[model samples]
Target: MLSGWEFIPFLTDYLGGDIHAPQEQFWFLNNFSDLVTSSFQNVCGGDVLNGRSLGILLIITLFVGWLFVKNDATNLLIYVLGVTLALCSTTFIDWTSLSHNELIMNTIGNIQFPFRLVPYAGLFLSVIASFVICNIIDGITSNNYKQILVIISFVLISVCGYFGTVQPALDRITQNVSEKYLKKTESKQTIPDDVVIDKYNYNAIFDYLTQTGETDYYSEKAYNNATSIINNIVYVNGKESKLIAEYKPNKIIYMIHAQKGDKIDLPVIAYKLTSVSDNGKKVKFNQSKRGTVEILARTNVNRIEVSYKPIVLYYVMMFIALLSWFGVIFYQVKNVKNRLIY
Candidate 1:
């Protein structure tokens, strides 16, 4: 119910396509959106709250206290006010030296807009308003009349909330879904290979790389250099230079039948953690000008293995996390068994 009233202004703004920053004239609590926008100064004009909505909110907030003075609603009102004030405190603080206070600035900056506190304020006001109305209804002389009044009040509140909040949200969702579907149908062109997809699409890939410690050597310069080298590579006896063995996520063995003093370039990015072995003997690997891993294959050497070794710390941390989860599960199981037996 509180959310419904709090979001009504936002819903109206969204519907009207007037969701931009408030104008200079509408800044400074003169409008609802201005009241919600972060920052003390309203240099960028955007949406502002409606005057009628503000008036209604103010009247309810002021008048509800009078109704709740004789009841326990006062305590709840105070608690609500305290919480709301705490959430809003950053808005009034001097942020001119925010650069010096990185932690404080980051915490507040995460909020995106200070005006978000307005919904919270509206929420608390709604709570107080509900309490006031209920308290007034409780004071009726007849029990039957009081019950009827309560039921009527609940129905009215529910109806108002549904229409004011849920309906607008549902309408917006339907509209967005329809528009997106239309766009999908209209789009026919293929995405270019060079075009980067949204980061969220590849977040899992990044997470996997991080977990395996494979992201340490991810340098853009190295990748670009490797691509250039691969493009200009000349192969001798290409049929003999083939992958001999493959292991997903870590190791690859290649048979490079290169003559004496022949440099065989492997199809892998050059990294410090990569270990190269020639014909079962450890060999020093060099990087191509393009940054791809390459090795000098001796005349007798027939096979080469390129293995990626992750840092030991990655395994240690994984083991520790696993152990902690196991310990927690054991403790919970033991407690549950004890309770059941007792």
Candidate 2:
């Protein structure tokens, strides 16, 4: 039940007891191969919108609790937990998803992070839409047929939605990797990433990697040996002309590689370096191992944007609940007055 907060920071890093972890960079660089190699590549390979789903569930439960349970911490905890769930949700959205598609899929590039979780909110909206339709049906029709129809609408729409958007994304990830290698014109000429390594001092090797963000210009084996401390790492863009690290003892390198002609609003992860390489270029450092702490972000444009679908959806649900409660109060008042002797 309480296994989610493994990556949460030590609270001092954040402004309001909230820490920041860039998502797009964290997953792709740290665990891209997991998705690329997985048989069920989509859901089984990486992450799906569990946080969004939980957040939606959390909000719906809280609102329903208002109708059923007394106002108390027990119910309030559910609301708080929903908010927490969304925060965790951002970490895994761009992962492989057999449930979502044939390969892996990521969110749109141009949108902000706060809006990144829109699909989840849209989903929450659909859920709310179904609920609204159900209640309207019950109040106006009161027939068994109406209830059955409402049930169908709820299931058909929600399931179709998540699966439809997700499945295609998986297909793209699977294809992109294969199609890319197939078209490589410099098949023999291109620099190989793996080669024999010479035994040398490990510190010098680490220093070389620290400066250039790589061990060798034409060898993945060298790069892998140096970054053995990390669990996994993958190239964000296909390849680059020897990536170099600007500087740092500990820093997160945020980079995005979008499709050709695709729209993107890459977030400003760094203020020091103004312009970076785009899709045709290599701007972000690829991490071989997952960091002790990780930030999850969408690989978009120049502004930092994290998806907040759960939060927004909860707010909408809460607002509806407040209005409903007010209506209930007014109805009670009118009944009391009509019964009083005049």
Candidate 3:
């Protein structure tokens, strides 16, 4: 959101309450009202001109206007004009009061703030300004001195623009990394194989798992109880029975070496779509308190499989999307061939 005076850097410090410093209730009330009021304010106050970045904007506007008048370049003119109008309407219009005009208000409300339009204004102005520069160069007589001067000016402007935008972005990234990651404290506790101790502290573990294409299941209760279930085997009374398993998003395979009535608690979050089977026969599964799938081992049962069957509608939609993409590719190829031949 904007505060109607965002263009003035000093006003931003006063308008948006500082994130680090403690503030009074009145400070919050004043700034909060400014945010909401700017979204619906129609008239620009006397201070508005002083707060606007109008110098560069004026130069771009003059170039675009010259193109519009000299060549009557309708395509470029219409685009620039449309973006200009959008920028003005967003900044100055009383959008919240236009409830009667549902379509316009709804569309503008989705954007949330008028200041976001400034980027598009800059982009369109840059494109039209480039065209105007090219036109000026074309109109000049074949003078080496004039041509070289124009080229040098363009290069300097480009270099200045690049450093002005990119250096600040790079500095901000360095500052954030130093504050969040470099200053974090180290931990010494040994985490269990089945447990993710502190998710925020072990974010890199989740990131690695995701990158390696493993399902990173997150259930507050389910993951916490996974360690307890495996440690204490309640149903089976046999020798040291160990269970080996392979996990998948929709399927799981387990090799259990346990006696009849022995149960193995899987480390996956239990869902209604999940089904369990043992040695080709379907078996009933119970969800533990932590929401993990619990399977009881039967006599001579060595292999167990748990699968999640996707719905029919999912496959149907995927098929339709695939066909639509193929149709689009075919159409584009045909159009390109036709254009080349003609």
lDDT of each model, Cα atoms only? 0.47, 0.35, 0.49
Off by over 4 Å in 3: 1-217, 226-242, 247-250
For model 3, residues 1-342, the per-residue Cα lDDT tens digits are 122222333232223422122111111111223323432331222122212222343334534455454556664675566456444534345544553466665455434445545445555655566556666775773464566577678789877755653453345435545334422223322322223223344433322222211222334454455454333222233233334345444566776666787766665555555678888789888876556677778865557788865445545656666777788899977875664455
Clash statistics: count for each candidate: 13, 43, 0
lDDT per residue (tens digit) for residues 243-319 in model 1: 32433346666665568777777656656566887888788987655455677767755577777654565456566
Residue 311, candidate 3: Cα error in Å is 1.1
Candidate 2 lDDT over 112-184, as tens digits, reads 2332443443344344434445556677655555555765786797687557446544554455453323221
TM-scores for the candidates? 0.34, 0.25, 0.36
**Judged by lDDT relative to the true structure, which candidate is superior, 2 or 3?**
3
Instruction: Output the worst ten-in-a-row residue range by lDDT, candidate 2.
Output: 265-274
Best-fitting candidate, measured by TM-score? 3
Better of 1 and 2 by lDDT: 1
The residue ranges of model 2 lying beyond 4 angstroms of the native Cα positions read: 1-112, 117-127, 174-177, 180-342
Ranking by TM-score: 3, 1, 2
Q: Model 3 lDDT vs. the true structure?
A: 0.49
Q: In candidate 3, which residue pairs get closer than 3 Å at backbone N, Cα or C atoms, i.e. clash?
A: none
